[model samples]
Target chain A: MNEKMSSRTLRTLPREKAFYFFTSIGNYTGESATSLKEFTDKISEVNVKSLEFHLYRGDFEKWTAETLEDQKLAREIENLRNQNYSGTALKEQLYNILSKYYEKIISKF
Target chain B: MKFKDNTVALDATDLRILNALQENARQTYTAIGKSLGIAHSTVYDRIKRMERHGIIKEYTAVIDAQKAGAKNIIAIMTIFTDPKESDKVAEKLCEAPQILEVYTSLSEELLIIAKVVAENQESLHEFIASSVAPLPGVLRIRTSMITKKFKETRFSIANNPKQLAFIKEKSNK
Candidate 1:
C-alpha cells in the first residue's frame, strides 16, 4: 500500500484536451498544457470543484453579435461578466435572457 | 440550457442559497441570509426543506487530493461476472479502504473510481496488484491519476447563456 500511494502521488490531474479546446476564448491554437495553465491562472481565484464547461446546449448560431449588442442584452451580458457573478448570477442572467426570447414568441401570438 | 424531465424547481432565493452553499458549504445560516438579503429564519427553513427534498444532499469540503496525502488512484475496473457473482464482486470492491467512489456504468463495466491517499506509491501499487485484482469477477483495472485540476466543481451550468452558447457552438460539427 505504501509503495502504491507513493506512485500515485507522482501523478497529477488529467487534462481533457477536447474539453479545454471548446471552452477556450477565441481560437486557441497553442500547446494544450501551456494554454490550460494560462487559463487556469486567469480563473485561479474562483473556487470551484469541477466546472462542467458545457460543450453542447445553447448554440451561438441562434443569436448574432448584433442581437447580443442590443442595449438591454448588452447590459445583461455586462452584468454577467462581473468577476463576482456566481452560480446564482449565472442562473438569473440565463432566466432573463430566455425570458426575452420567450417575449419575442409571445408577442407574435 | 434545458434540464432533464426531473429537473428540480427552485425560486430565486432558493438558487441564491444553493449558490452560496456551493461556494462554501460550512457557511452558517446567518451568514448565508446576510449575503442573500434574506432573513435568517427563512434561510433555515429553506435549507430544511431542501434537505428533506434531497436537493442539498450533504455538506462537504472540497479537499485537495494531493494535500490529503492519500493514494488517489482513479481507475475503471471492469468486473466480468454472472448475475450470481455480481453481488459477490460488488461486495468485495466496496470493502476496499482506498476506494472513494464507485459506479456501475451502462456499458456493463464496473467503473470503480478510487482516491487512495496512502503514504507512498509502492503501498498503493501493492494494494492494487495484490488486493484489488485478486477479487473474484475482477477482470481488468485501468488507472489514471489526475495530473492537474484545471477546473472542478459539483455546480452545474444549466442556465448561463454565454456558457450554454459556448458549449452549443463547440458541439455542433
Candidate 2:
C-alpha cells in the first residue's frame, strides 16, 4: 500500500508530464504541477474557472491516471466528476480529496 | 427573484469569516478565528461550507504589475449596441480574453461597459477596431483610457454594520 502511494502519487514528474493548468483552450495559468502534492496546492490557488473547465472535460482523471499512474486517485476524481459538481463546489470537493490522499501518504513517513 | 431558490443565507459566523478572509487570505484558520472568538476547526468548517456553496472561490495573490513586467494599459469602453442584440453582444464580449470584465448598463440606451487591458495603445486600437467594432450588434464604441488608478477593491465587509445579523460582534470588532 505504501509503495502504491509513494512513487507516482508523490514523485515529481518531468516537465513533459506536468499538469499544465488552463482556464480555456489557449489560456494557460502559468502553473505546471509536477506532483500530486503540487497539483493539490495549485488547485487551491488557481482560479476556480480553470478548475471548473478541467472538471467538466474529465482532464483531472486522465492526468492523475495516465501521467501519475495512480488509478485509485483517478477513480476518486472520476467519481467526483460524474457527480456534476460545478464552480466552487467542484473545487472544494477536489481539494478535499487530494488533501486527504496527501495526508494519508505523509502519515506513513 | 432568481436568488430565492439557491441563496446561501450567511449567518453571523459566516459573515465574520468572510470579513477575515477579505483582509488577508494568507492567514491561517487560527488567525482568522482569533478575532472572532472561534476555534480554528470552526473556522475551517465554516470556510469549507462557504466553498461548497460556491460563495467562497479561490484565494488570490496580489502582484505588483509594474515590477513583474506585466504592466497593462487599462481601457474602459462603453459600447452601444442594438437593443435586440445587447445580451448576445455582452456574452460574446465575455468570451474575448482581452476584455477583463463585462457589465450591462441599466440606463435607457443598450450599453455595455467593458474593462479591457492591452500591452500598449496600438494593441488597444487593434482590439477595438478589429475585434470589438466589427461585432454583429455593435453600433458604436467609445473607449476611455485610464491614466492612473486611485483605488480598486472588491468588497468592504466591515463598512456594513447596520445588518441586524452582525449585531453580535458590535462591541470589540
Candidate 3:
C-alpha cells in the first residue's frame, strides 16, 4: 500500500460498520468509531486493554480492510501486529497511523 | 532504543516526565515541559513513544468506591481451582465484567484471588451462585464481604512486566 488512500476509501463508513471497542471476549467498552478521525480520537483515549484485545485478535485490520475497503491501513495494522506490539505501545502506534489518514480525509472536504 | 538487555533506553528526561505525569496526570504537556526546561513537543513525542513501548498505560480517576456510588459493594473472592485447569478458570473469571482484578498466588493449592463489585448483597450472592459457582474445575470459592476499608493504593503501571518487547531478535534473524 502507498502512503495515501484513494478518495473513495477516505469517506465515512456506515454506522453499523463502526469499529466497536471491547475489553475482553464478550465485554464491550461502550465505544465505537465510525470514521477515520473518530477511530483516531477514540483509539487515543479508549481503554488500553480494549485496544490490546482487538489488536491481537486482528479486529482492527479486518474492520478497516473489509468494511472500510482500506487495504492500506489494514496492511499497516498487520505490520504493527506482526512486530509484537501490545498494550499502550500498540495504541500509540495505531493512533499515529490513524491520525495521518484522518488529515487526508478532512483535507478533501 | 534498547541495549544489550531488553531494557528501554530511557534517560533522566523520561524519568522526569514520568514523575510529572505520576504526580498529576491532568497537567498539560506545556506545563510538564516548563517544569522540566524542555520543549513541550519533545515531551509530547517522548510520552507517545513511551506509551508505544508500554511504559505508560492509561490515565484514570481514582475514586472512593463507597462515595462514588459506582462500585459501592466490594468483595474479595478466592477460588481454588484444580491444578490442571488453573488458567482456564482464571480466564473464565476474567470474562465477567464484575471481576475488577485477578491475581494468582501459590498456596497449598492454586489460589485465584479476585476483586469484584456488585450493587447489593442479593446481586452479589446471585453473581457468585450463578456465575461463579458453576465454573468447571473450581474446587471451592471463599468470599469475604468487606465491612469497611482502611487503606487503598493506586495500581501503578510501572509494575506491569508485560511491556511490549522489541522484535529485534526476530528482525535480526
Candidate 4:
C-alpha cells in the first residue's frame, strides 16, 4: 500500500526547474528515441528523470513488457496508467516504483 | 494585390510550386506542374519571379555532419560586450571560421553560436582561449554545449497554412 502511494508520488514530482522533464530528457539523452524500447534503454544510463517522464506519459507498460521483458513490472505499471495525473505528478510516481525495483534487485546480491 | 508586408504577392499556384520545390529542390518543373495541375512554363515563370523577389534563396543540400567526419562540439555563447562596441564585437565574431551563426539579441549581449572540430576537449579549450576570449570589448563569455539536436529544418512552406490560403486565393483570381 505504501509502495503504491510512493509510486504515484514519483510520477507527479518535477525533475528540474530549468525545463520540463520531457524537454530535459531530450536535451540530455539526445532525441533519437524512435521507439519506447529505445527511449527506455537509452535513458537507463542517464538520469532516472527521463525514465520517469516516459512512464508518466504511459509508456512503461509497453516498455516493461516488450523491452525489459518483465511481465510483473508491466502489470505494476499498468495500474497507474490514465489516472488523470499531471506530467510532474506522474513522473514522481514512476520514480518511486523504479527506485524500489532497483533496491529489490540490489538487495538480492 | 500586394502581401501584408508589401512584398510581391504570390498566388495559389506559386505557393503550390514553392511547397513542392521545398520538399525536393531537385524535382523537375514538369513533375511540379503535373502535381499542381499547371503548365510547366507557368511553374518555371513563377519560380523565376520568386527568385527575383528574394523569396527563394539558394537551394542547398542537407548533409549529415557526423558521417562526413565534421562532427564537432556545438556551443551557444552569450557574449557580453561594451554597449557601444557590440557591433564591432559581432563583426569580429563573424570573421572567426569556427563561428557558424552570429546575431545581436534585444539585450546588450551578442549571441554567437559556433561549432569547433578538434581532436579532443583540451584542443577545443585552447582554440577558444586563444582565438575567441581575446577579442576586443569581450567583457564576458558564457557558453552552453549542445549535447543533442532533435530537429533541424530548412524553410517549411507546408507549416504556414495562412500564407498558403492567401496565395491560393490570389491564384483563383
Candidate 5:
C-alpha cells in the first residue's frame, strides 16, 4: 500500500518541459553557415538522439542527433534532441496513461 | 415568459468557490475554506452542489503560452456570409490547427484567436500569410500579438455582486 501511494504521488505531480534555441542568425553574415555547421556538428558528435520539435500548428517534428551542414541549425536540432532524448518518450508514455485517468476523472462528473 | 426549467440559482458560497476555482482549479478544499473562513466540508458541499447544477462543468489547466512554445495572437475577422453559410464557415474555423480559441460575440464582434509557436518572426509571418487569411469565412483579418496575459477567468461561483437578482432574472430570460 505504501508503494502504491508513492507511485500515486509521483503520478499526480505536475512537470513542465521547456526548450530554447538561438535561431536569430542574420543574413549577409559572412561565414555564418560554416560557423553554425561546426557548432551543430560538435553537438551531433556527442551522439544524442530522440528529440522532437513542435511546430506552431501543434505538429511534432523529430530531431535526430545527426550532423547538419549549418552549425547553428544543428545546435537547434541538438538542443531539442538532448532535452527530449529519453524524457520526451517518457512524456508520451505518461500521457497515454494519464489520458485514461482523465477519462475516469471526467466520467465521475 | 416561462423560465427555462434547467436554469438554477447559485448562492453566495457557491459564487465565491467558483471565482476562486476558475483562477486555480487544483487549489485544495482546505485552502479554499481557509480563504473564506468556512469549514472544509462546507466548501466541498458547495462544490458538489455546483457540479450537480452544471455550474462547475470541467477543470482545466491554463498552460502558459510561452512555456508551451506557442505565442498567443488575437485576430478579428468579419465574414460577409449569409446565415446559411455560417455553419460551414464555423466548421472550417474549428478545424484550423493554428486557431486556439474562437468566439462569436455581439453582432459587431466576431473574433478568432490563434497561437503559433514558430522559431522566429519570419515563420510567424509565413503562418499568417499562408494559413489564416485564406479560410472560407474570412472577409478581412487583423492580427495582434499578446504581450502579457492580464486576467483570464472562465467560471465564477458568485453571482455578479452589484447586479441584484433582478438583473440576473432578466438576463436568464
Candidate 6:
C-alpha cells in the first residue's frame, strides 16, 4: 500500500532539475562538520530541558498544543513546569513523550 | 584597508552595498552608490575587496525548475557503508550531476543525507540504481522525497544590528 502511494506521488511531480538543500543530523562525520557544530552550539543555548524556561520564554507548550496538535502532550509539559525534576530528567521525559507521539503519528503514515 | 586584526574590514557603507547587491546582484555599482549615498568608485572598490577576500563567491541566477522544463525532486538518502570507504563513496557521489549536496550524520549509524535533482522519477530511480546502490561498500540505501518546500534563500547576511556587528568584528579581525 505504501509502495502504491509513493509511486502515484512520484508520477504526479513536475519535471525539472530540482535544487535540493541537504541537512544531515546525528552521527555525521564529514568535511562540513562546521554545520553540526553550529547546530549543537545553538541547541545548547536553548536550554531545551528547562520546563520553566519553556513555559516563561519559549513556546514549548504552545508548539505542542498548536503545531503538533497534541493537547495532552502540551498539558503534560505544562504539568512538568511545576514539578521538581532536574533539567536532564525533564528533557528525558519530554523526549519520551515526543518519541511516543511520533511513533503513533508516523504509524498512520 | 588592513583592520586591527589584519583582516579586511567592511564599514557600514560596504554592508549597505552588500545588502543591496544581495537583493539584486545585477544592480549597477552606480545605482548602489546612489542608493547608499556613496561614490560609484568606492562601491566598486569595496565589492572588489570583498570578492578578493572570498566573502562574495559567485553571482548566479535562481531559476524556477518547473518553468525551465525540469522537475525538482528533493530526496534525503542514507547511504550505509563501511566507515573506511565513506570518504571514497562520497567523492564518487559528488561526480553525479543529479546529486546536489551530501552530508554525513553524527549518529552511531553512519548515514548520508543527499539532495538530488532529476528530470523525472525514472531518471532519479536509474541514478540511484546505477550510481548509488552498486557502490561496493554500500550496505543499505533509504530515500525519502521532499514533497514541498516552505522557504529557501541564498543570502546569509541579514540587516539586523547584531549580525552587522558580528560581520564587522570578524572582518576587522
DockQ scores for all predicted structures: 0.01, 0.01, 0.01, 0.01, 0.01, 0.02
Candidate 3 local lDDT, B1-173, one digit each (tens): 96576568876677668867877999999999998778999999999999988788788887765576575688888777778888887899899999999988888889889998888766776576557655666666677877888977665434333321222222233
lDDT winner among the candidates?
Answer: 2
- Residue-level lDDT of model 4, residues A33-98, one tens digit each, is 333233333444435555555556555576456544556667777776656444556556655666
Q: How would you encode candidate 5's per-residue C-alpha lDDT over A1-109 as one tens digit per residue?
A: 2444323322321111101111121111011111222323332322112112222111122211121112333344334434533444534432343344334433443
Docking level for model 1: incorrect
lDDT of 2 at B101: 97
Model 2, range B25-115, lDDT digits (tens) per residue? 8899998878778899999998998898888878888777879989789888888888999999899899999899999996878799999
How do the residues A35-87 of candidate 3 rate in per-residue lDDT, one tens digit apiece? 77778899998888988888887888988898788887789889988988777
TM-score of each: 0.44, 0.57, 0.51, 0.53, 0.43, 0.52
- Candidate 6 chain A: worst-modelled 10 consecutive residues by lDDT: A25-34
Q: How would you class the docking of model 2?
A: incorrect
Task: Please write out the lDDT profile of model 6 over residues B1-173, one tens digit for every residue.
Answer: 76676577777677777887888899999998887777999999999999988778899988887799766676767787778778888888888887889887758877666888776555665577546765656656767777888987765567477867765675465
> lDDT per residue, candidate 1, B1-173, as tens digits?
12487566666667667767776778899999887667999999988988877888888767776687754544333434445556675667678776665555535543434444344444554565446555545544555444565875565443566654553454352
Residues A1-109, candidate 1, lDDT per residue (tens digit)? 2434323322233333111221221111211221222333423322221111211212121121222222343344444444344454444544455455434533443
lDDT of 6: 0.60
RMSD of each: 28.5, 23.7, 24.6, 18.2, 21.2, 18.3
Model 6 per-residue lDDT at A71:
68
Q: Kindly state the number of residue pairs that clash in model 2.
A: 0
lDDT of 5 by residue, B88-170 (tens): 65666677675555555336545433344444555554554345444444444444444556886553433455534433453
lDDT of 1 at B120: 49
Which DockQ-derived CAPRI band holds candidate 3?
A: incorrect
Off by over 4 Å in 2: A1-109, B1-3, B159-168, B171-173
Clashes of each: 36, 0, 1, 18, 10, 16
